[model samples]
Target: MSEHFEPPEGGNKKVALLIAVLALMLALAEIGGKQAENEAVAKNIEASNLWSFFQAKTIRSTTLSTAADAMEIDLAAATDAAMRERMQKRIDDWKKTVARYDSEPSTNEGRKELTVRAKAAEHERDNLKARNENFEIASGLLQIGIVVASASIITGVVILAFVGGGLGALALGFMGLAMFAPHLLF
Candidate 1:
Protein backbone atom coordinates (compact mmCIF):
# COMPACT_ATOMS: atom_id res chain seq x y z
CA MET A 1 0.00 0.00 0.00
CA SER A 2 2.22 2.78 -1.31
CA GLU A 3 -0.65 5.02 -2.32
CA HIS A 4 -0.42 8.75 -1.52
CA PHE A 5 -3.21 10.30 0.65
CA GLU A 6 -4.01 13.34 -1.44
CA PRO A 7 -7.32 15.05 -0.85
CA PRO A 8 -10.02 14.48 -3.47
CA GLU A 9 -10.87 17.46 -5.64
CA GLY A 10 -14.02 19.59 -4.96
CA GLY A 11 -16.80 19.05 -2.34
CA ASN A 12 -15.33 16.02 -0.54
CA LYS A 13 -12.58 18.23 0.91
CA LYS A 14 -14.94 19.09 3.79
CA VAL A 15 -15.05 15.44 4.83
CA ALA A 16 -11.27 15.36 5.01
CA LEU A 17 -11.39 18.30 7.41
CA LEU A 18 -13.95 16.43 9.52
CA ILE A 19 -11.63 13.42 9.73
CA ALA A 20 -8.74 15.64 10.83
CA VAL A 21 -10.79 17.29 13.56
CA LEU A 22 -12.07 13.94 14.83
CA ALA A 23 -8.55 12.55 15.02
CA LEU A 24 -7.40 15.57 17.01
CA MET A 25 -10.28 15.10 19.42
CA LEU A 26 -9.38 11.42 19.79
CA ALA A 27 -5.85 12.38 20.75
CA LEU A 28 -7.08 14.75 23.42
CA ALA A 29 -9.41 12.11 24.83
CA GLU A 30 -6.61 9.57 25.02
CA ILE A 31 -4.36 12.00 26.85
CA GLY A 32 -6.99 12.79 29.44
CA GLY A 33 -7.80 9.09 29.89
CA LYS A 34 -4.17 8.20 30.50
CA GLN A 35 -3.68 10.97 33.08
CA ALA A 36 -6.78 9.98 34.96
CA GLU A 37 -5.82 6.29 34.93
CA ASN A 38 -2.36 7.06 36.28
CA GLU A 39 -3.72 9.22 39.11
CA ALA A 40 -6.23 6.52 40.00
CA VAL A 41 -3.48 3.95 40.32
CA ALA A 42 -1.45 6.23 42.55
CA LYS A 43 -4.40 6.94 44.80
CA ASN A 44 -5.18 3.24 45.06
CA ILE A 45 -1.62 2.52 46.21
CA GLU A 46 -1.79 5.32 48.78
CA ALA A 47 -5.05 3.96 50.18
CA SER A 48 -3.60 0.46 50.44
CA ASN A 49 -0.52 1.73 52.29
CA LEU A 50 -2.62 3.81 54.68
CA TRP A 51 -4.85 0.86 55.46
CA SER A 52 -1.83 -1.31 56.19
CA PHE A 53 -0.41 1.30 58.56
CA PHE A 54 -3.78 1.55 60.27
CA GLN A 55 -3.84 -2.23 60.76
CA ALA A 56 -0.36 -2.20 62.29
CA LYS A 57 -1.34 0.58 64.67
CA THR A 58 -4.44 -1.33 65.69
CA ILE A 59 -2.36 -4.42 66.50
CA ARG A 60 0.10 -2.43 68.58
CA SER A 61 -2.69 -0.72 70.51
CA THR A 62 -4.36 -4.06 71.24
CA THR A 63 -1.14 -5.65 72.45
CA LEU A 64 -0.33 -2.72 74.73
CA SER A 65 -3.84 -2.72 76.18
CA THR A 66 -3.64 -6.50 76.87
CA ALA A 67 -0.25 -6.11 78.58
CA ALA A 68 -1.52 -3.26 80.75
CA ASP A 69 -4.49 -5.35 81.89
CA ALA A 70 -2.26 -8.33 82.73
CA MET A 71 0.17 -6.12 84.67
CA GLU A 72 -2.68 -4.67 86.74
CA ILE A 73 -3.82 -8.25 87.64
CA ASP A 74 -0.25 -9.20 88.74
CA LEU A 75 0.12 -5.96 90.77
CA ALA A 76 -2.85 -6.97 93.04
CA ALA A 77 -0.90 -10.05 94.33
CA ALA A 78 2.34 -8.02 95.16
CA THR A 79 3.01 -7.59 98.88
CA ASP A 80 5.66 -4.86 98.57
CA ALA A 81 4.12 -1.39 98.37
CA ALA A 82 7.06 -0.06 96.31
CA MET A 83 6.79 -2.87 93.71
CA ARG A 84 2.99 -2.42 93.51
CA GLU A 85 3.40 1.33 93.00
CA ARG A 86 6.01 0.80 90.22
CA MET A 87 3.85 -1.79 88.49
CA GLN A 88 0.80 0.57 88.62
CA LYS A 89 2.87 3.42 87.13
CA ARG A 90 4.15 1.18 84.29
CA ILE A 91 0.63 -0.05 83.59
CA ASP A 92 -0.61 3.56 83.47
CA ASP A 93 2.10 4.42 80.95
CA TRP A 94 1.11 1.51 78.67
CA LYS A 95 -2.57 2.53 78.88
CA LYS A 96 -1.67 6.07 77.81
CA THR A 97 0.40 4.77 74.89
CA VAL A 98 -2.51 2.55 73.81
CA ALA A 99 -4.85 5.55 73.90
CA ARG A 100 -2.41 7.61 71.85
CA TYR A 101 -2.24 4.89 69.18
CA ASP A 102 -6.02 4.71 69.05
CA SER A 103 -6.45 8.44 68.41
CA GLU A 104 -3.47 10.80 68.18
CA PRO A 105 -4.98 13.87 66.55
CA SER A 106 -1.74 15.88 66.71
CA THR A 107 0.41 13.33 64.83
CA ASN A 108 -2.40 12.12 62.56
CA GLU A 109 -0.68 8.69 62.58
CA GLY A 110 -3.17 6.99 64.85
CA ARG A 111 -5.53 4.20 63.82
CA LYS A 112 -8.53 6.56 63.63
CA GLU A 113 -6.62 9.16 61.59
CA LEU A 114 -5.22 6.55 59.23
CA THR A 115 -8.70 5.14 58.67
CA VAL A 116 -9.96 8.60 57.68
CA ARG A 117 -7.02 9.18 55.34
CA ALA A 118 -7.37 5.77 53.69
CA LYS A 119 -11.08 6.33 53.07
CA ALA A 120 -10.34 9.71 51.49
CA ALA A 121 -7.74 8.17 49.18
CA GLU A 122 -10.17 5.46 48.16
CA HIS A 123 -12.77 8.08 47.32
CA GLU A 124 -10.30 9.98 45.14
CA ARG A 125 -9.27 6.78 43.31
CA ASP A 126 -12.88 5.92 42.57
CA ASN A 127 -13.57 9.35 41.09
CA LEU A 128 -10.47 9.17 38.91
CA LYS A 129 -11.51 5.74 37.65
CA ALA A 130 -14.89 7.12 36.60
CA ARG A 131 -13.25 10.00 34.75
CA ASN A 132 -10.89 7.62 32.95
CA GLU A 133 -13.80 5.47 31.81
CA ASN A 134 -15.59 8.47 30.35
CA PHE A 135 -12.45 9.54 28.47
CA GLU A 136 -11.98 6.02 27.14
CA ILE A 137 -15.55 6.04 25.77
CA ALA A 138 -14.98 9.45 24.18
CA SER A 139 -11.80 8.24 22.52
CA GLY A 140 -13.63 5.27 21.00
CA LEU A 141 -16.46 7.43 19.64
CA LEU A 142 -14.03 9.94 18.11
CA GLN A 143 -12.05 7.13 16.42
CA ILE A 144 -15.24 5.78 14.89
CA GLY A 145 -16.18 9.27 13.80
CA ILE A 146 -12.85 9.67 12.02
CA VAL A 147 -13.34 6.36 10.21
CA VAL A 148 -16.87 7.25 9.16
CA ALA A 149 -15.81 10.69 7.92
CA SER A 150 -13.03 9.14 5.84
CA ALA A 151 -15.52 6.65 4.38
CA SER A 152 -17.76 9.56 3.35
CA ILE A 153 -14.89 11.03 1.32
CA ILE A 154 -14.20 7.67 -0.41
CA THR A 155 -17.81 6.66 -1.18
CA GLY A 156 -19.15 10.17 -1.94
CA VAL A 157 -21.90 9.47 0.61
CA VAL A 158 -22.40 13.02 1.96
CA ILE A 159 -24.80 11.83 4.70
CA LEU A 160 -22.04 9.75 6.32
CA ALA A 161 -20.19 12.97 7.06
CA PHE A 162 -23.14 14.27 9.06
CA VAL A 163 -23.28 11.01 11.06
CA GLY A 164 -19.57 11.22 11.71
CA GLY A 165 -19.90 14.85 12.80
CA GLY A 166 -22.67 13.86 15.19
CA LEU A 167 -20.49 11.19 16.72
CA GLY A 168 -17.64 13.66 17.15
CA ALA A 169 -19.97 16.11 18.83
CA LEU A 170 -21.11 13.42 21.26
CA ALA A 171 -17.52 12.53 21.97
CA LEU A 172 -16.79 16.16 22.79
CA GLY A 173 -19.61 16.18 25.33
CA PHE A 174 -18.20 13.09 27.00
CA MET A 175 -14.74 14.67 27.17
CA GLY A 176 -16.18 17.80 28.72
CA LEU A 177 -18.10 15.80 31.26
CA ALA A 178 -15.01 13.84 32.16
CA MET A 179 -13.09 17.04 32.85
CA PHE A 180 -15.74 19.13 34.57
CA ALA A 181 -18.37 16.81 35.96
CA PRO A 182 -16.83 13.40 36.36
CA HIS A 183 -19.38 12.31 38.93
CA LEU A 184 -22.15 12.92 36.42
CA LEU A 185 -20.09 11.39 33.60
CA PHE A 186 -19.75 8.16 35.53
Candidate 2:
Protein backbone atom coordinates (compact mmCIF):
# COMPACT_ATOMS: atom_id res chain seq x y z
CA MET A 1 0.00 0.00 0.00
CA SER A 2 1.13 3.57 -0.66
CA GLU A 3 2.18 5.65 2.41
CA HIS A 4 -0.59 7.86 3.79
CA PHE A 5 -0.11 11.47 4.79
CA GLU A 6 -2.26 13.46 7.23
CA PRO A 7 -2.56 17.23 8.05
CA PRO A 8 -1.72 18.43 11.51
CA GLU A 9 -4.47 19.60 13.85
CA GLY A 10 -5.71 23.20 13.83
CA GLY A 11 -4.10 24.07 17.15
CA ASN A 12 -1.65 26.37 15.40
CA LYS A 13 -4.56 28.37 14.00
CA LYS A 14 -5.99 28.79 17.48
CA VAL A 15 -2.63 29.90 18.82
CA ALA A 16 -2.28 32.39 16.00
CA LEU A 17 -5.69 33.77 16.79
CA LEU A 18 -4.76 34.10 20.45
CA ILE A 19 -1.59 35.96 19.51
CA ALA A 20 -3.56 38.35 17.34
CA VAL A 21 -6.02 39.13 20.09
CA LEU A 22 -3.21 39.60 22.62
CA ALA A 23 -1.43 41.99 20.28
CA LEU A 24 -4.56 44.09 20.00
CA MET A 25 -4.90 44.21 23.74
CA LEU A 26 -1.26 45.21 24.06
CA ALA A 27 -1.80 48.07 21.64
CA LEU A 28 -4.74 49.38 23.57
CA ALA A 29 -2.85 49.15 26.85
CA GLU A 30 0.07 51.05 25.38
CA ILE A 31 -2.16 53.84 24.14
CA GLY A 32 -3.89 54.15 27.49
CA GLY A 33 -0.60 54.17 29.39
CA LYS A 34 0.73 56.94 27.20
CA GLN A 35 -2.37 59.05 27.73
CA ALA A 36 -2.27 58.61 31.51
CA GLU A 37 1.44 59.42 31.65
CA ASN A 38 0.91 62.59 29.64
CA GLU A 39 -1.91 63.65 31.92
CA ALA A 40 0.24 63.05 35.00
CA VAL A 41 3.04 65.14 33.57
CA ALA A 42 0.69 68.00 32.71
CA LYS A 43 -0.90 67.95 36.16
CA ASN A 44 2.50 67.88 37.85
CA ILE A 45 3.60 70.91 35.87
CA GLU A 46 0.42 72.77 36.76
CA ALA A 47 0.85 71.99 40.46
CA SER A 48 4.45 73.16 40.40
CA ASN A 49 3.48 76.43 38.72
CA LEU A 50 0.72 77.04 41.22
CA TRP A 51 3.04 76.39 44.17
CA SER A 52 5.60 78.78 42.73
CA PHE A 53 2.97 81.47 42.36
CA PHE A 54 1.84 80.87 45.93
CA GLN A 55 5.40 81.25 47.19
CA ALA A 56 5.81 84.50 45.26
CA LYS A 57 2.63 85.86 46.76
CA THR A 58 3.78 84.89 50.23
CA ILE A 59 7.09 86.65 49.73
CA ARG A 60 5.44 89.80 48.44
CA SER A 61 2.92 89.83 51.26
CA THR A 62 5.69 89.41 53.80
CA THR A 63 7.66 92.28 52.27
CA LEU A 64 4.66 94.57 52.33
CA SER A 65 3.92 93.62 55.97
CA THR A 66 7.49 94.37 56.94
CA ALA A 67 7.37 97.74 55.23
CA ALA A 68 4.13 98.59 56.99
CA ASP A 69 5.66 97.72 60.37
CA ALA A 70 8.66 99.93 59.65
CA MET A 71 6.38 102.81 58.64
CA GLU A 72 4.36 102.37 61.81
CA ILE A 73 7.51 102.77 63.86
CA ASP A 74 8.43 105.88 61.88
CA LEU A 75 4.96 107.29 62.40
CA ALA A 76 5.18 106.69 66.18
CA ALA A 77 8.41 108.73 66.37
CA ALA A 78 7.44 111.43 63.84
CA THR A 79 7.18 115.01 65.21
CA ASP A 80 5.50 116.51 62.10
CA ALA A 81 1.77 116.18 61.36
CA ALA A 82 2.15 116.12 57.54
CA MET A 83 4.84 113.40 57.72
CA ARG A 84 2.69 111.38 60.14
CA GLU A 85 -0.34 111.67 57.81
CA ARG A 86 1.69 110.55 54.77
CA MET A 87 3.15 107.64 56.73
CA GLN A 88 -0.30 106.55 57.95
CA LYS A 89 -1.69 106.62 54.40
CA ARG A 90 1.25 104.57 53.11
CA ILE A 91 0.80 102.08 55.94
CA ASP A 92 -2.90 101.72 55.15
CA ASP A 93 -2.15 101.12 51.45
CA TRP A 94 0.44 98.51 52.29
CA LYS A 95 -1.99 96.72 54.59
CA LYS A 96 -4.61 96.74 51.86
CA THR A 97 -2.13 95.27 49.37
CA VAL A 98 -1.16 92.56 51.83
CA ALA A 99 -4.79 91.67 52.45
CA ARG A 100 -5.46 91.51 48.72
CA TYR A 101 -2.49 89.20 48.25
CA ASP A 102 -3.80 86.92 50.98
CA SER A 103 -7.22 86.43 49.40
CA GLU A 104 -8.10 88.26 46.17
CA PRO A 105 -10.85 86.46 44.26
CA SER A 106 -10.93 88.88 41.33
CA THR A 107 -7.41 88.15 40.12
CA ASN A 108 -7.32 84.56 41.44
CA GLU A 109 -3.61 85.04 42.11
CA GLY A 110 -3.74 85.27 45.87
CA ARG A 111 -2.18 82.75 48.25
CA LYS A 112 -5.50 81.09 49.09
CA GLU A 113 -6.50 80.62 45.47
CA LEU A 114 -3.06 79.45 44.48
CA THR A 115 -3.00 76.89 47.28
CA VAL A 116 -6.38 75.55 46.25
CA ARG A 117 -5.28 75.29 42.63
CA ALA A 118 -2.04 73.55 43.55
CA LYS A 119 -3.86 71.01 45.68
CA ALA A 120 -6.36 70.33 42.90
CA ALA A 121 -3.56 69.79 40.40
CA GLU A 122 -1.82 67.46 42.80
CA HIS A 123 -5.02 65.46 43.24
CA GLU A 124 -5.39 65.17 39.47
CA ARG A 125 -1.81 64.06 39.16
CA ASP A 126 -2.39 61.33 41.73
CA ASN A 127 -5.41 60.08 39.80
CA LEU A 128 -3.43 60.02 36.56
CA LYS A 129 -0.63 58.12 38.22
CA ALA A 130 -3.04 55.50 39.50
CA ARG A 131 -4.53 55.05 36.03
CA ASN A 132 -1.08 54.88 34.50
CA GLU A 133 -0.04 52.18 36.91
CA ASN A 134 -2.97 50.00 35.89
CA PHE A 135 -2.30 50.56 32.19
CA GLU A 136 1.37 49.78 32.61
CA ILE A 137 0.58 46.53 34.38
CA ALA A 138 -1.93 45.59 31.69
CA SER A 139 0.60 46.38 28.99
CA GLY A 140 3.11 44.11 30.64
CA LEU A 141 0.65 41.26 30.92
CA LEU A 142 -0.46 41.64 27.32
CA GLN A 143 3.11 41.69 26.10
CA ILE A 144 3.77 38.45 27.96
CA GLY A 145 0.63 36.93 26.48
CA ILE A 146 1.69 37.86 22.96
CA VAL A 147 5.09 36.33 23.44
CA VAL A 148 3.72 33.13 24.98
CA ALA A 149 1.03 32.77 22.37
CA SER A 150 3.58 33.22 19.61
CA ALA A 151 5.70 30.51 21.17
CA SER A 152 2.69 28.20 21.40
CA ILE A 153 2.01 28.72 17.71
CA ILE A 154 5.59 27.82 16.87
CA THR A 155 5.62 24.75 19.10
CA GLY A 156 2.06 23.63 18.30
CA VAL A 157 1.11 23.60 21.99
CA VAL A 158 -2.56 24.37 22.48
CA ILE A 159 -2.28 24.46 26.27
CA LEU A 160 0.35 27.21 26.16
CA ALA A 161 -1.84 29.18 23.81
CA PHE A 162 -4.76 28.91 26.20
CA VAL A 163 -2.59 30.08 29.06
CA GLY A 164 -1.47 33.10 27.04
CA GLY A 165 -5.03 33.86 26.07
CA GLY A 166 -6.02 33.78 29.72
CA LEU A 167 -3.32 36.31 30.52
CA GLY A 168 -4.56 38.54 27.72
CA ALA A 169 -8.08 38.36 29.06
CA LEU A 170 -6.83 39.30 32.50
CA ALA A 171 -4.99 42.22 31.00
CA LEU A 172 -8.13 43.35 29.29
CA GLY A 173 -9.93 43.23 32.63
CA PHE A 174 -7.30 45.46 34.14
CA MET A 175 -7.62 47.88 31.24
CA GLY A 176 -11.34 48.09 31.85
CA LEU A 177 -10.82 48.76 35.52
CA ALA A 178 -8.29 51.45 34.69
CA MET A 179 -10.80 53.21 32.51
CA PHE A 180 -13.56 52.97 35.08
CA ALA A 181 -12.07 52.73 38.58
CA PRO A 182 -8.33 53.14 38.58
CA HIS A 183 -8.30 53.63 42.31
CA LEU A 184 -9.61 50.13 42.80
CA LEU A 185 -6.28 48.54 41.94
CA PHE A 186 -4.26 51.06 43.84
Candidate 3:
Protein backbone atom coordinates (compact mmCIF):
# COMPACT_ATOMS: atom_id res chain seq x y z
CA MET A 1 0.00 0.00 0.00
CA SER A 2 1.26 3.41 -1.01
CA GLU A 3 0.39 6.64 0.91
CA HIS A 4 -0.05 9.51 -1.55
CA PHE A 5 0.40 13.02 -0.08
CA GLU A 6 -1.00 16.13 -1.82
CA PRO A 7 0.50 19.62 -1.38
CA PRO A 8 -1.57 22.48 0.06
CA GLU A 9 -3.67 24.31 -2.55
CA GLY A 10 -3.31 28.02 -3.45
CA GLY A 11 -1.08 28.64 -0.42
CA ASN A 12 1.67 30.58 -2.23
CA LYS A 13 -0.80 32.72 -4.23
CA LYS A 14 -2.80 33.59 -1.11
CA VAL A 15 0.32 34.63 0.77
CA ALA A 16 1.56 36.68 -2.20
CA LEU A 17 -1.79 38.51 -2.47
CA LEU A 18 -1.81 39.29 1.25
CA ILE A 19 1.73 40.68 1.11
CA ALA A 20 0.84 42.85 -1.88
CA VAL A 21 -2.23 44.21 -0.14
CA LEU A 22 -0.28 45.15 2.98
CA ALA A 23 2.38 46.85 0.88
CA LEU A 24 -0.22 48.88 -1.03
CA MET A 25 -1.89 50.03 2.17
CA LEU A 26 1.44 51.13 3.65
CA ALA A 27 2.35 53.02 0.48
CA LEU A 28 -0.97 54.87 0.40
CA ALA A 29 -0.59 55.87 4.05
CA GLU A 30 2.90 57.22 3.36
CA ILE A 31 1.68 59.31 0.41
CA GLY A 32 -1.17 60.75 2.43
CA GLY A 33 1.24 61.71 5.22
CA LYS A 34 3.67 63.40 2.82
CA GLN A 35 0.91 65.39 1.10
CA ALA A 36 -0.32 66.61 4.48
CA GLU A 37 3.23 67.68 5.32
CA ASN A 38 3.53 69.67 2.08
CA GLU A 39 0.27 71.49 2.70
CA ALA A 40 1.43 72.38 6.22
CA VAL A 41 4.73 73.77 4.95
CA ALA A 42 2.91 75.85 2.35
CA LYS A 43 0.63 77.36 4.98
CA ASN A 44 3.61 78.10 7.22
CA ILE A 45 5.42 79.89 4.38
CA GLU A 46 2.40 82.11 3.68
CA ALA A 47 2.10 82.94 7.39
CA SER A 48 5.78 83.83 7.66
CA ASN A 49 5.60 86.09 4.60
CA LEU A 50 2.50 87.86 5.91
CA TRP A 51 4.06 88.34 9.36
CA SER A 52 7.15 89.90 7.76
CA PHE A 53 5.03 92.18 5.56
CA PHE A 54 3.02 93.33 8.56
CA GLN A 55 6.20 94.22 10.44
CA ALA A 56 7.58 96.13 7.45
CA LYS A 57 4.36 98.14 6.96
CA THR A 58 4.25 99.04 10.68
CA ILE A 59 7.85 100.30 10.49
CA ARG A 60 7.14 102.28 7.32
CA SER A 61 4.14 104.01 8.90
CA THR A 62 6.17 105.00 11.96
CA THR A 63 9.09 106.30 9.88
CA LEU A 64 6.74 108.33 7.70
CA SER A 65 5.16 109.88 10.79
CA THR A 66 8.61 110.78 12.18
CA ALA A 67 9.69 112.31 8.87
CA ALA A 68 6.51 114.38 8.66
CA ASP A 69 7.02 115.72 12.21
CA ALA A 70 10.64 116.64 11.47
CA MET A 71 9.60 118.37 8.23
CA GLU A 72 6.93 120.38 10.07
CA ILE A 73 9.56 121.75 12.48
CA ASP A 74 11.95 122.50 9.62
CA LEU A 75 9.24 124.31 7.60
CA ALA A 76 8.53 126.62 10.53
CA ALA A 77 12.22 127.72 10.60
CA ALA A 78 12.64 128.05 6.79
CA THR A 79 11.97 131.25 4.77
CA ASP A 80 12.66 129.76 1.27
CA ALA A 81 9.42 129.30 -0.74
CA ALA A 82 10.91 126.89 -3.30
CA MET A 83 12.30 124.61 -0.57
CA ARG A 84 8.96 124.81 1.27
CA GLU A 85 7.11 123.88 -1.95
CA ARG A 86 9.39 120.89 -2.53
CA MET A 87 8.99 119.70 1.03
CA GLN A 88 5.24 120.19 0.86
CA LYS A 89 5.10 118.23 -2.41
CA ARG A 90 6.96 115.38 -0.76
CA ILE A 91 4.41 115.36 2.08
CA ASP A 92 1.54 115.54 -0.44
CA ASP A 93 2.92 112.54 -2.31
CA TRP A 94 2.94 110.55 0.91
CA LYS A 95 -0.66 111.56 1.63
CA LYS A 96 -1.75 110.69 -1.88
CA THR A 97 -0.19 107.23 -1.61
CA VAL A 98 -2.05 106.70 1.63
CA ALA A 99 -5.31 107.83 0.01
CA ARG A 100 -4.71 105.61 -3.01
CA TYR A 101 -4.15 102.64 -0.73
CA ASP A 102 -7.39 103.39 1.07
CA SER A 103 -9.45 103.85 -2.09
CA GLU A 104 -8.04 101.01 -4.16
CA PRO A 105 -10.72 98.34 -4.61
CA SER A 106 -8.39 95.42 -5.09
CA THR A 107 -6.40 95.55 -1.85
CA ASN A 108 -8.62 98.04 -0.04
CA GLU A 109 -10.74 95.08 0.90
CA GLY A 110 -7.67 92.86 0.75
CA ARG A 111 -5.68 95.04 3.12
CA LYS A 112 -8.18 94.45 5.89
CA GLU A 113 -8.80 90.97 4.62
CA LEU A 114 -5.09 90.21 4.54
CA THR A 115 -4.66 91.44 8.08
CA VAL A 116 -7.42 89.11 9.19
CA ARG A 117 -6.09 86.34 7.01
CA ALA A 118 -2.57 86.92 8.25
CA LYS A 119 -3.67 86.51 11.82
CA ALA A 120 -5.63 83.38 10.95
CA ALA A 121 -2.73 82.02 8.95
CA GLU A 122 -0.42 82.56 11.91
CA HIS A 123 -2.77 80.54 14.06
CA GLU A 124 -3.06 77.90 11.35
CA ARG A 125 0.74 77.75 11.06
CA ASP A 126 1.07 76.99 14.74
CA ASN A 127 -1.59 74.32 14.46
CA LEU A 128 0.11 72.80 11.46
CA LYS A 129 3.45 72.77 13.24
CA ALA A 130 1.89 70.86 16.09
CA ARG A 131 0.10 68.58 13.66
CA ASN A 132 3.34 67.76 11.91
CA GLU A 133 5.00 67.10 15.22
CA ASN A 134 2.16 64.76 16.16
CA PHE A 135 2.36 63.11 12.77
CA GLU A 136 6.05 62.44 13.32
CA ILE A 137 5.31 60.80 16.60
CA ALA A 138 2.49 58.79 15.08
CA SER A 139 4.69 57.69 12.20
CA GLY A 140 7.30 56.48 14.65
CA LEU A 141 4.66 54.59 16.58
CA LEU A 142 3.22 53.12 13.39
CA GLN A 143 6.70 51.97 12.38
CA ILE A 144 7.07 50.19 15.67
CA GLY A 145 3.63 48.63 15.28
CA ILE A 146 4.51 47.37 11.81
CA VAL A 147 7.79 45.95 13.03
CA VAL A 148 6.15 44.19 15.91
CA ALA A 149 3.35 42.90 13.75
CA SER A 150 5.81 41.64 11.16
CA ALA A 151 7.80 39.90 13.88
CA SER A 152 4.63 38.25 15.21
CA ILE A 153 3.67 37.15 11.70
CA ILE A 154 7.13 35.72 11.10
CA THR A 155 7.03 33.91 14.41
CA GLY A 156 3.68 32.37 13.45
CA VAL A 157 5.12 31.21 10.14
CA VAL A 158 8.10 29.69 11.91
CA ILE A 159 5.81 27.88 14.32
CA LEU A 160 3.73 26.56 11.43
CA ALA A 161 6.85 25.39 9.59
CA PHE A 162 8.19 23.62 12.69
CA VAL A 163 4.86 21.90 13.24
CA GLY A 164 4.41 20.84 9.62
CA GLY A 165 7.95 19.64 8.94
CA GLY A 166 8.99 18.42 12.38
CA LEU A 167 5.70 16.72 13.10
CA GLY A 168 5.94 14.72 9.87
CA ALA A 169 9.48 13.65 10.77
CA LEU A 170 8.50 12.78 14.33
CA ALA A 171 5.50 10.75 13.15
CA LEU A 172 7.83 8.74 10.89
CA GLY A 173 10.21 8.15 13.85
CA PHE A 174 13.09 9.99 12.11
CA MET A 175 13.38 12.29 15.21
CA GLY A 176 12.84 10.81 18.69
CA LEU A 177 13.63 13.99 20.67
CA ALA A 178 10.80 14.40 23.19
CA MET A 179 11.23 18.17 23.19
CA PHE A 180 10.22 18.27 19.49
CA ALA A 181 7.21 16.04 20.17
CA PRO A 182 3.63 17.13 19.35
CA HIS A 183 1.15 18.68 21.81
CA LEU A 184 -0.33 15.25 22.51
CA LEU A 185 2.96 14.29 24.22
CA PHE A 186 2.58 17.20 26.66
Best by lDDT: 1
Using all chains and alpha carbons, the TM-scores for the candidates as numbered come to: 0.92, 0.91, 0.54
Of candidates 2 and 1, the better by lDDT: 1
List lDDT for all candidates, in order: 0.91, 0.89, 0.52
- Candidate 2: deviation at residue 102, Å? 0.8
**136 Cα displacement, candidate 3 (Å):** 3.6
Clashing pairs in 3: none
Indicate whether candidate 2 or candidate 3 has the larger lDDT: 2
Clash pairs for candidate 1:
none
* TM-score ranking, high to low: 1, 2, 3
Candidate 1 lDDT, tens digit per residue, 82-168? 999999999999999998998999999988899999999999999999999989999999988988888888877777899999999
Compared with the true structure, the alpha-carbon lDDT of candidate 2 equals 0.89
| Pairs of residues at least 3 apart in sequence or in different chains that clash in candidate 2 | none
lDDT of 2 by residue, 1-186 (tens): 895433267767767777888888888899999999999999999999999999999999999999999989989999999999999999999999999999999988889999998999999999899999999999999988888888776666667777898899889889988899989979
Q: Which stretches of candidate 2 lie over 4 Å from their true place?
A: 1-9
